[model samples]
Target: MSSDLSLQQIAESVTKSVLNATDKDLEGFQKIIDETIKVRESHRNLQRMIKSYSTTMIQRS
Candidate 1:
């Protein structure tokens, strides 16, 4: 399922989960890290889009 949560908020939740997790739960923690990377990548993509849009608008004006 998809979520409306922000990357920073999800990252913080994952961080807290990892801190309290046991050594046997490392695999799940790794999954959380992978998801966090995806979130960050998505944020980067959004930033790029905004920058491109702003540049195009400036050139038009």
Candidate 2:
């Protein structure tokens, strides 16, 4: 009786721990994705700036 109750408690605790860890992993994954998007956008902006500068130089030449 007591042993069965202990086992049930342990199982519930394990389930809760697994769920919390999964939530943390998802949050971390989302943060990484957001950072990746920011880096990609910055790269695109830099490329546009370079292209514009090149066009201006070509026009002057």
Candidate 3:
């Protein structure tokens, strides 16, 4: 009976550890995703500026 209790305790500890590690990993992934979105938005804005400048130059020419 004691052995069974020890086994149950070990299983619960391992489960908690695994859950915590997974949560940390998910947080890291979310941060990466957020940064990627920001970078992509900046790139798009830069492209729009370039396009506008090119159009203006063509009209001036």
Q: Compare the candidates by TM-score and give the number of the best one.
A: 2
User: Candidate 2: deviation at residue 18, Å?
Assistant: 13
How good is model 1 by TM-score? 0.60
Candidate 1 lDDT over 1-61, as tens digits, reads 7669897987888887778889879887778779989999999999999999999999999
Whole-model lDDT, model 1? 0.89
lDDT by residue for model 2 (1-61), tens: 3445575786687676556677677688679779989999999999999999999999999
- Per-model lDDT: 0.89, 0.82, 0.82
- At residue 24, what lDDT does model 1 achieve? 73
Write down the TM-score of every candidate: 0.60, 0.64, 0.63
Question: How displaced is residue 35 in candidate 2, in Å?
Answer: 0.3
Off by over 4 Å in 1: 1-24
In candidate 3, stretches whose alpha carbon ends up further than 4 angstroms from where it belongs are 1-21
TM-score of candidate 2 versus the correct structure, residues matched by position: 0.64
**Model 2 misplaced stretches (Cα beyond 4 Å):** 1-21
Give the Cα error of residue 5 in candidate 3, in Å: 48
lDDT for each residue of candidate 3 in 1-61, tens digit (9 for 90 to 100): 3445575786687676556677677688679779989999999999999999999999999
